[model samples]
Structures are given as C-alpha cells and as structure tokens.
Target: MSEVQELTKTKEKPLWYVVFTYHNAEKRVEEHINSLAKTEKYDGLIIKAEVPVQKRTVSRRGKIKEIEEKIFPGYVFVKAVMTPEVMAAIRRINGVAHFVGGGNEPVPITPEEVKRARIQDDLSEEFKAGDTVMITDGPFENFIGKIIKIEGRKINIALSLFDREMGIDFSPEQIMKIQ
Candidate 1:
C-alpha cells in the first residue's frame, strides 16, 4: 500500500471505550452507533464499535447446534476519540445503558487491553465438547460443567445446578481459561 493509504487506515483507529449496554443489547447498540456514524452529527469523529462474539453449542435430543454468542454480555467496545457530539450520539443510541467510566466523561479502552482479547486463530480448536470442568469464580462458585465447544474466549457449558441441566455461557474472565 502507498504511504497515503497506510496513513488513512491508521487514522481510523482511535481511543477505545468500554461501554455498558442494556441487557442483550450488544448487537443493537453496535448497529445504532454504526448507523449514526454516517450522519453529520458526528462529523470528523471516527468510531469503531465492536461487540466481541463467540460460538456456542447446544444439544437437543442427541443433536448438537451452534450459535453465535457475545463475548461480553451487556457490554460493547467503541474505539473513537470522543467529541461533544460523538458522546451525545452514543448516549442516544438504543440499548446503550451507560458507559463504565465515572460520570459522563468519556474513557478509552486501552490498546493493550484490546490487544489482550485479540483472536488466536491459528491455535484454535473445536475443543473436546463435553469435557467436565469446575467453575473457579464468578457468582457460580465450585460449580462443575460439561464443555460443549471452545469458540474464541467463550465456552458453552452444560451445567446442572440442582439437577436442572441448564446451559451456562461464559467468557475467559468469568472462568479458568486453562484446563
């Protein structure tokens, strides 16, 4: 690519923000933000919204199904150097509960943190679906589960909490990432 092309692409990145969205609102929030991006309300302000997604597996009567699951429930990441109008539009977006930072002041998601959650495509595996594991933390402590698949950072676990065999979905931070 030419130097000018590289420069244009580099300008696309901005300070990132960790946003707290309404329950089950990650997709809608992202869509709204992206749509607003084309309007003049956010002129010259560039924002990249991301709702990290993962894959999930479900079993029904001896059959398995795959589903797309969000990595951070009720949360979405936005990369943009916020201007006054940009911030205003963000709050107006549907399914946006609030920003994690204190007050209305804008905060950016660190480049390092974003990089930490980066996808590892080469080392990926269709994890041995159905391997039992124990939850190390979160609200569900000491809980054991059966792994259905390993999709990015999320895991679809078949957990029996009091004989109710329900499927619990979790991210890397919510459980022990290691075996």
Candidate 2:
C-alpha cells in the first residue's frame, strides 16, 4: 500500500518470457537457465525455466515406446523479473539463441498462450485396441485403420497403404471410431 511497498511489489513481479534455443536444445537451455537461477547473479531475478512437453506413444521396429515430446520445439518459457543484466545473462547461455519478440526488448508470453502450450492431450476413454478408426488428419486423412496399440495418449494404428499393412502412431485426436 505504501509507495516503497508498491515499488517493491511491481519490481519483483515476474513475467513469462520466451527464449529461442538452437535445434534440439530446448531442454539444455532450460536446464542451464534453472542452474543459473541458483547463482548470485540470477538469484531472485530468475524464477523458473520450463520446456513444455507431452507424453506420446511411438512405434519403432514393432516396439511400442512412450516419449516426451516438446510442445513447442526450440522454445523455453522462463519466469523472471525482467532486467537488462538478466536478459544479457540468458542470451549468454549456451544453446540459447535469444529471447523472442524482437531485438533488445523481449515481450512476455500471455497467460492464455502459456496455458494452451501447457495443456496435455488426454487419451480418449472410448477408444481401445482392435477398434476400427478413421484417420482424421495428417497424410493419412480419411483413411480407415484398425487400432493396434494404445499407449498413454498415442494410438498406434495399422493402415493399409499400397496394399501393405503399415504401422503408424497417432494422437487420439487424429483418429476417430469407425462406428
């Protein structure tokens, strides 16, 4: 309520900034930023760094595996009190290219956009293995296939392509029940 208190509150308020990293370096950048948060230079100024990811099922060589895929590749979200020194330090981190939203001034991410980026696709309860489905998106759109495996939010389907059965993995939203 006091002037000094108000100043302190506004100064400490953290906003989410988007940092662009090199190809396949989102995780590394996030870790580096987090590690720097504990050091004297970044203490309090840097709050947290996060790379949004979702669990996906992948099929390779007849083996079904779950993998965590980045929701937004090459980007990491960082919560921090924006300061010139902090921005410079982030840019200096290895694997981090620069902050998004133009040159020196970086824009903070909107709360809505952050929420959407963090949302995880839920597995459809109505779908199960052996169920016939129709591909709704991607290169196999409208193609009919049979569910081969259900792992987490990924649905492995067997589709006839070029007269041969090919195994493919899709998110639940990409396929619908044939019935």
Best by TM-score: 2
| Per-model CA lDDT versus the true structure | 0.66, 0.79
Candidate 1 lDDT, tens digit per residue, 75-119? Answer: 878765576767777888877878878787967755467776552
Report the Cα lDDT for residue 105, model 1: 90
Candidate 2, residues 1-179: lDDT per residue as tens digits? 76434443354445689998999998888888989888997766887888898999999999999999888999999887789889889999989888899767999877578678883323443567898877767999868889999887678999999999999999765765654
For residue 91, model 2's alpha carbon misses the true position, in angstroms, by: 0.6
**Reference-based lDDT, residue 99, model 2:** 88
Give the lowest summed-lDDT range of ten residues in model 1. 119-128
Which pairs clash in model 2?
none
Give TM per candidate: 0.55, 0.61
Weakest lDDT window of 10 consecutive positions for candidate 2: 4-13
Cα lDDT over the full model 1: 0.66
